[model samples]
Target: MAHNALPRPSSLPGIEDLRRGYTPSTHEARQSIEERSKQLRLEQERIDAELDRHIAEMQRLSLRRRDVVRELDLNHALLAPVHRLFPELLSEVFIHAVQDPFNVQKTDFAVRVLCGVCTTWRAAARATPLLWTFIDLSYITSLEDPLLRLQLQLSGQLPLTVTAKVQDQAMQLLLVAFFDGMSDEDASRVVEITVEDDGVVLSQLRSRHLATLRVADVNIWDTCTQGELGFLTSAPTLHKLTIGVQYECEDDDAALAFPVPVIPDLPCLTHLILAIENEFPVSAFLPAISQLAPVLRVLKMSSFEVSAWEETKPTVTCEMHVLHSLELQHYTHRFLTFITAPALHAVTLIGDDAQLGKEDPTESLLDLLTRSRPPLRSFALHDPMQGSASALSGCIDLMEGLQRLNIEDNERGVTSSPRLAAVLQRLVCDENTPPMLPELRSLSVQCRGDKSPCVHSDVAAPLSQVRLSRKDPRVCAGRAVAALE
Candidate 1:
């Protein structure tokens, strides 16, 4: 392209006189100077006009260049490898890219990002029903919000896992609408539900195939009546139930008023977890387990008030014939006296070390083992309040079939080193007696208290002997000794 050359002023009328600093003393000379100044002003305006035109032209060309680059980039993107991928494969990629679709707080952003990528990706995302199956209405601001409806619609007939935090009246209304909008078939496709209740009576989950239900409440005073939870009784396929409640009891007498939520008999219920916060009398809830799901395989309980059972012994004993695993926290060995699990294989107990005066759980554990004679393989005891060496050794003597044993003394009290050493010594086999745990494959002893030299020296010999006897010895000692293989 040919460009026009900018014009320059040839010369000033009195250029030589002005350079020489000649004064315009006469009227004619001053008049002549004024005329030249006027001409110069006219020329300057013409030059500025020309510059403006060229500047405008350059800007126009720059915009055109940008448009051309964008077009080329779009064309190149169309030929990319990802564009060649089948929609089905791309949908799977989208599914993996989005982590925890049920967590609306995070997955909602991911879904939006995937949809905003391109028309093809948006179509693939909408077509993938699995991505939309988790309909979280926890933060739904308005009933008119289309995201919730879109999720349900795109999910189609696939099984849904719904989660909602019913914090206010608006959220409760949305939750109701969420269920009301669903067709009978769509409702039946709901397999799992997690609801955090805040004194709201939730719409009964009407799914016949409902397998898991997790309900948590920060306030225990707002009780869910049996009538409110009547839907659980009809949910025959429900296998897992988790109820977490935070109770604020003012006094010991308040525990007497503790209301036990109606837990309906779920015949197929296999796993049950009750996480109760704050101090509530164990008697208020423990006895009810006898009538819980008969075929329950796992029972985990936490944060229960450990009552002095010596003063008031529990007459009622819970018999769980098919229970395979049991875990309890903030409890004494006395609590074990109230339960019997014959099929139990794993037991984890986290004792309240603050209550150092409590009786050792060794006898209670021995009693339970003798009573049930379960094929116990794994046992983990953490911070036992009054764990004695003799008591622990006696408990080990009963568990000849134990495969994994983990004992942790976090307090490192006066008895911590001797207790750990005694347990290790009990594991050693001699000429007179048979091995304590012949099937033992893993032993983990952790003492967080002061490390006594005698502990390492005493347990080292026993640990070496035990390792020599076993084909695969995996012993991990924390702060006391190094791991042995």
Candidate 2:
């Protein structure tokens, strides 16, 4: 199409006279001004029309560009490798993407996100029963809420790991109803139960198929009767049991005087963890340990204290023939003197300076190792107050078959530099004297406290000597030094 030229107002005959301020005194001059003005208005209108056409064309091209981009993106997504994966493989990917399915705070978040992605993903997520097996009752607001029932239905007949945080009487009643409403098959499918409740809920709930049970904040005085804890004895398949007791009484002595609930003999039990908030009398649980020693493979005791009266009493040693791993936290040397593990391979002792009392922990440990003489492979000591350089050296000298050693010194004013330096120096091989822990494959030493400039210098030489002499490709060294502010 041919276009008309736009009028140049400056080229108009009378326009220059108007710019020079020439007054139109005559009728012809005034008429000429009016004619010029009329022409200029017509040119402005044409320019505005041309701009509107350009804007419309730009809008149309922008819409076309948007459409093309959308098509390109869609085609790229269709050609992606993940889209070609089968539904089963896609579901597996979704499963791995979900982190900590049993966590109450993030319960069902991953599954809900997967279901919202697309129709195909929603179908795959719904078809995978393992994705819905974690039943966290803490998120359920009411018994009438269909979320719980939906999870149960979606999980199908798979083994469910249930976590319940029943804090009030209403939640307790709800928990009771939840168990009572379950079918026999559903009840049998619950293999693991972690409940943060008082003893009442656990007393009533029983499952023969239960393999693991963790009860937190259990009030020993509430469930004093044997009948209340009879459910524990009924689960023949139970292998792991963790009990955490927290006493809120003002008189800790009085609380300690109360009788501890006698744990029924668990024939199949292999792992037992007891965490007490206050310093509990060891006498209360000593007999129970003696009873469970034969079948127990892993035993962990925390915050245990031997009463002054009990300290005067004779130490009754309990022999554990099959126990392999033992961890003690905030414990005294007297407690270690009472047990002997012949098959122990791993020993982890975590305590502060106050827990060491007057007794040397190294001596007690040496006694245990000498008495039992098990093939100890791994040993970890965390901030023992009495762990002097000489004392630690004496203990490490006995572990000839040790493979892994971890020492963490977090004592406030005490640094593990001296102890670690001495231990590493002993490990260095000499022509005359053989190296201690010749089979050691892993060494981790962490020292946290006010340290001197020479702390690292003191430990570095010995550490380098041991590392180079050991020359084993599998030897791994982890050294951490932190200054306390």
lDDT (tens digit, per residue) of candidate 2 on 168-267: 7877777667766766677667777666555556667553444434322233323333333455565666778777655333456445554455677678
Displacement of residue 202 (Cα, Å) in model 2 is: 3.2
RMSD of 2: 10.8
Model 1 regions more than 4 Å off? 1-84, 99-107, 142-144, 176-181, 199-228, 249-257, 304-313, 332-334, 353-363, 384-386, 412-416, 449-461, 471-485
- Candidate 1, 94-126: lDDT as tens digits: 777665546455447546687887899889988
TM-score of 2: 0.70
The per-model lDDT (C-alpha) reads 0.66, 0.68
In model 1, state the lDDT of residue 98.
Answer: 65
